[model samples]
Target: MVRIKQRYILFDILSPPSSEHWEAYSESRDSALLHLHQVSSSEISAKYLLQVIRQVLQDHYGDFGAGSAGISLVVKYFSPKTSTGIIRCGRQHLDMIVAVLALINRLGDKEVIMRCIHVSGTIKKCENVSIKRDKEDIIRMQRKRK
Candidate 1:
């Protein structure tokens, strides 16, 4: 007989946005929150979470791909209200939590930080950024190659 083990990774972030803030952004925030539960372990899924973190970091720090420095920013700004003991898990899951927490700290927004901790899935790539360029920009650069 063969045995297969299922691995579970769970995290939670507690950022208590005020009623006023929630009311103002409730629709969009709720939509994003709903999507979090749908996240899964796939390249595309990891990429999407990365995209969200990148946007949050850029909005707060005005840059992306900041590496460890960025991680420091996240940890410094996002205060940890509480953290469950690190259960024995894969390094990937632990790394994801670290990266997410770092970003939350950088934002210095407790509400957002809390929400991020609860984000679904493990952040696979902590340092990769998705490059979004229009077709014209791509062609212009390709033409410049010659």
Candidate 2:
């Protein structure tokens, strides 16, 4: 029997502007899609990836408004062998990011094994890292013993 391990990765755009804000919105969308494609092609399964992406979008922006608002470009990827999944949010909303991460953490205690999650965004002057890690390096470091 082939031992299979499931991994879930969540990528959020974190405040994608409406289409009216085209210049900034388009750039943000492109950057996010590129990053997700790069990450997903590595080893993630496309089917599962799509599932997560759909769920996140529905959860954040209601299914009714996604199509009309031009936020319907979310991408997903899956690996054929192991079925590893990656979900990339088309337009990132900061509040949505917070909600998604919180949900992931809650679910992490359950069945899903969150192998790797990446969130990219510009930091505002007043925010702090709740899941402390070196911002310069994407590799998350656990808290060191004092």
Candidate 3:
């Protein structure tokens, strides 16, 4: 049996800077502190994300685009606080998948921008890029405070 090559794309989910700046941090951490799960967590989950992508795929490229790109598409990780996530897709459909991601202008009711970071053959590299970007965001946030 041959293996199917895959690519992991790191993307940032950016929404308009909310009037409530600490909302993301509090929403993510408050639940953790209670050791309880929020019934409808404010976090943008992978499942919902996949559904949106599939819907958009169908809208833009019809069933063919959705089927071809949805083969192995998945949101690997999503941190609402930082608004960052990773998605895995088949290598053969990288272009179409990325286009779908770029085409995504909103998630739910909120208007958002999806920015593609580094696309890598390995999830580890994609993860590294995710961590590095998070760190930069933290630093930038800190500077604003001081």
For each candidate, the alpha-carbon lDDT, in order, equals 0.35, 0.36, 0.76
Q: Highest lDDT, which number?
A: 3
Query: Residue by residue across 22-125, what tens digits does model 1's lDDT show?
Result: 65446564443433223222232233333455565456545443342234322212112222111122333345444544565322222334233222222232
**1 or 3: which has the higher TM-score?**
3
Candidate 3, run of 10 with poorest lDDT? 31-40
* Per-prediction TM-score: 0.24, 0.30, 0.77
Clash number for every model? Answer: 15, 14, 0
Tens digit of per-residue lDDT, candidate 2, span 36-120: 2222223334543445544654666686534432242333443333223333443434345335444442121222323334443
- Candidate with best TM-score: 3
The lDDT-based order of candidates, best leading, equals 3, 2, 1
lDDT of 3: 0.76
TM-score of 2: 0.30
Superposed on all Cα atoms, the candidates' RMSDs to the truth, in angstroms, are 16.5, 17.6, 7.3
Off by over 4 Å in 3: 17-43, 144-146
lDDT of 3 at 122: 97
List, residue by residue over 1-146, the lDDT tens digit for candidate 3. Answer: 99999999998775544465545545654332222211223746888988988888889989888888887899998776566778999999888888988899877777676778889999999998888866775676576558
Is 1 or 2 the stronger prediction by lDDT? Answer: 2
